[model samples]
Target: MANGWAPDGAVQDQIDDTVKDAVLRARGMMPSGDGSDECDDCGEDIPAARRAALPGTRRCVACQAKRDATLRSVGINRRGSKDSQLR
Candidate 1:
């Protein structure tokens, strides 16, 4: 049963929505159009393998890893208090 008066599939719907949001966010982050031969950040040459694998990759592995590391973490409060949800 769902907590409080939420509908039968509310919990599952929340989970599905969270996954969908993450997928959309990832897709938005993906490179579009043609990839360059050089890393956008460091100007180092992007490997052919990465360009082929990702299709539109631009940054080298190291630069990309650094950029990924700099991204802020997003947390879902699955266990948020009912009072918190009310606000």
Candidate 2:
């Protein structure tokens, strides 16, 4: 299975790298430390129940949902090659 210009195992290497990047990104997105009393994004009070339940939340429900929506709209392109850029 010789790729025209890629060396052997290059495809698998790309896949592995993509998976590793995704894992690192997911870990970075994890909440950390004690939950803040106020929303970090909107300056609104975070509910006691939300803080208690999530333990490390920094945003109110509305702000958190908005942040999540923004994140969801931004897709990560692991394969940042020129071909991928063209597409």
Candidate 3:
């Protein structure tokens, strides 16, 4: 069933696009490339095991935990909800 101004699959397309965008965003957050021997935030030495385990880590566990703690949810509702808009 087609809705006003949209084709049959328009809503589904939006959902797929949103999922794709979220996947891309999460992938971008992951560390990549040849990482560091030390923490990027602190001067603490990154362990060999951790470096090998994560493959591309720049921060030690403690510093990374602090950084993760400060992260906030910035997601926006693309579905046009009044509650989301108010926030």
The number of clashing residue pairs in each candidate reads: 0, 0, 0
> Could you tell me every candidate's TM-score relative to the true structure?
0.83, 0.61, 0.71
Where does the lowest 10-residue lDDT sum fall in candidate 3?
72-81
The residue-by-residue lDDT of candidate 3 on 2-86, one tens digit each, is: 6787789888887888888888887888899989999989889999999989989999999998988898755646677788778
- Which model, 1 or 2, shows the larger lDDT? 1
Q: In model 3, which regions exceed 4 Å deviation?
A: 1-14
Give one digit per residue, the lDDT tens place, for model 2 in 1-87: 647887898878878887887888878887898779998888989999988888899989998788877886344575577987998
lDDT tens per residue, model 1, 50-80 = 9999988889999999999999867566657
> lDDT (0-100) at residue 49 of candidate 2?
95
Which candidate, 2 or 3, has the higher TM-score? 3
lDDT for each candidate structure: 0.87, 0.82, 0.86
| Top TM-score hit | 1
Q: Report the C-alpha displacement of residue 6, candidate 2, in angstroms.
A: 2.0
